[model samples]
Target: MKKNGGIRFLRWLILFAKRFLKDDMPASSAQLTYYLTLALFPFLVFLINLLSYTKLSTWSLTEDLLTVLPAGTMQIITSVIRETIEAKSTTLLSFSALFALFSTSRAMNALNRALNKAYRVQGTRPIWKNAMLSFLFTMGLIVLIVATLSLMVFGQLIGEHLFTLLGASVYFLHIWNLMRYFLPVAIMVLIFSLFYRFMPNTEVRFSNVWRGAVFSTIGWIVASLLFSYYVNRFGSYTRVYGSLGGIIVFLVWLYLSSFILLVGGEINAVLLYGDSKIK
Candidate 1:
């Protein structure tokens, strides 16, 4: 029974993949990539600036980013972050915040459209309503990122203290180290699940969303690791694009990331609607 169930699931997944492609994921992804690129630097600057006033340093923020981003991409991001911190001018803060809000909302809007398409639902929200929802989502994402960074920075300290109080052994420390990596990925999955649940026009059950979230998170991690490995080993965008290679690479990465996100939403749609045509 289990084996047959697995086969049936695979068949459904294959059909979902076909439907996703038919829905024009690539075009939507490209649009998302553009908005993401517009938002990326401003959002990072705003975030780093906000963190600078706190206990966290730019290096800590960069390290958190390094966990998921490729080496070259990380370098580019870190350089910009460092520059933003060193400039120390409040003049850009207002501008950065506004730009980040607008661009991020635009990106979220694109995702909202993609999700609606996947769910076979027509968009019924007014412009103001949609913009407000996007704004809220954008803020939620920023908060999620800040919380994740805080955990990465302080989780170890808290763990060590708890472990020492309990008289735990070295094995626990090893496990904690692994959790440091796994926790961020788990948080990402939860965030993706939230996006799946709330972003679409149609309602989704939490149970069904989790299936897609897990699938999407695993797919994202595998794709990111493989892309990073390929880039580190054989990729040479710098030789081809000179100083602009990093930007090019970043854009391509955003596109792939957007594609993965849509695929996840498609999975949820398939499960929810069961091969129904778009409404």
Candidate 2:
């Protein structure tokens, strides 16, 4: 039974690889990277505007991004945030909101098409319907991002307060500190799973999506860590590209992320269909 299981698994892996290549996922990822790049700054401006009305407005959101973003990318993001704050205005906010919606919807449409291709489904949804769904997904994604960031930023403080109120041991914080990192990962898995299950125009069981979600999450985390290390140690983008280095690095990172996300959907399609033909 063990030998048979291993053989079957190897066969599945081979099939998945073959189909992944046939799907031309790299090209799709490139398209996604373009739309994502266009949406990114607009989305950030919209989020900042929304957060300005909340306590989190004072929080340095870029600080958290520094963990994974390259120095050049971080510099660009910091500069953008500073400029946005310095030039805050209702007119700018409204314009950003509209631009964000339009750009994010385009990004979501790209994602939708990619996932549809991954699942080997025809995108039969009308343009308006797709636009509406993309808008909804964008809003949901923005909320999820804010929530995740809030949890990461305030989770420890909240935990400490609760511990103090409950008269818990100080050692509990060490455990909380460890668990905090894992918690965001869990949320990320949930987010990805939800997207995998729904973003595609097909019915997918939660069970079918969970494996892909976990794979994508771990793959993304590992890739980001490795890339960050590479950037910090050997990359001299600033010397090479001058002020534009940051944008270049950021686009490369987005491309990697987009590829991983689409590949996750491909993984789900493979597992769900098993050894069946993928066209």
Candidate 3:
């Protein structure tokens, strides 16, 4: 029975790969990349504006961004943030915040369409309804991002304070340190699970979404690490593209991210609904 189950699992995995390729992942990824390129700076400006009203240190926010972004890309992003802050252009900030919200929703709309295609469902919702949903999802995503950054910036401090208050041993600090790494992973899983559960038009069980979310999150982390390593070691984009290399690299990263997200949606579709529609 175990052997049969293993064989079935392998078959499913193979089918998923085939489906992912056939699903026009490249086109969808390109669309997402375009939208993201338009949205990136605006989104960052919106975030910075929101953070300005809070007690959170902008330095911590930059640090959090640097953790996930490639070094070259992060440098470009940081420079933009610094310039924007130094310029103190409220008009630009306000315009960027509104534009980012709408543009991000537009990107989410594209994602919604991709998810529907993955599930073999035609979009039946009204355009306005879909737009509203996308808008909500965009807002949710921004909140999730800010919350995640806050955790990364302050989680250790909070943990240490709690431990001291509880009179815990020094070993607790070691455990907290370990948890700092896992905390981001856990938050990512939660975000992915929510995306899987709600972004698609069809009903998906929480259990099924969790499975795909975990798989996708691990895949994304692996792919990102590998891509980062390759870029650092062998990439010569700067030599070829001159000053535009960083932008190119950022777009490629966004494309990879989009592909992985759609792949994850496909996995959930296959797992929940089988390969009947995906063939």
Residue by residue across 111-201, what tens digits does model 2's lDDT show? 8888888788888888888878888878777776766676678778878997899898988888888887787788789888888987888
Give the clashing residue pairs of candidate 3, or none. Answer: none
lDDT of candidate 1 over 164-255, digit per residue (tens)? 99899978977887787788778878888889998888777789899888988898778888887877779898889988877777777778
Model 1, position 81, has a per-residue lDDT of 82
Cα deviation at 45, candidate 1, in Å, is 0.7
The backbone clash count of each candidate, in order, is: 0, 0, 0
Can you write out model 3's per-residue Cα lDDT over 1-279, one digit (the tens) per residue? 999999999999888877777777778878977887788789888777666767877877778657666656777888877877666566877899888988888788888888888887888988888888888778777776766776678878978897989999999988887887787788778888888888788888789888878887898788877777777778898899989888877788888888888788888888887778865
lDDT of 2: 0.82
Error of 1 at 196 (Å): 1.1
Clashing pairs in 1: none
What TM-score does each of the candidates earn?
A: 0.88, 0.90, 0.90
Model 2 shows how many backbone clashes? 0
Q: Which stretches of candidate 3 lie over 4 Å from their true place?
A: 1-6, 52-56
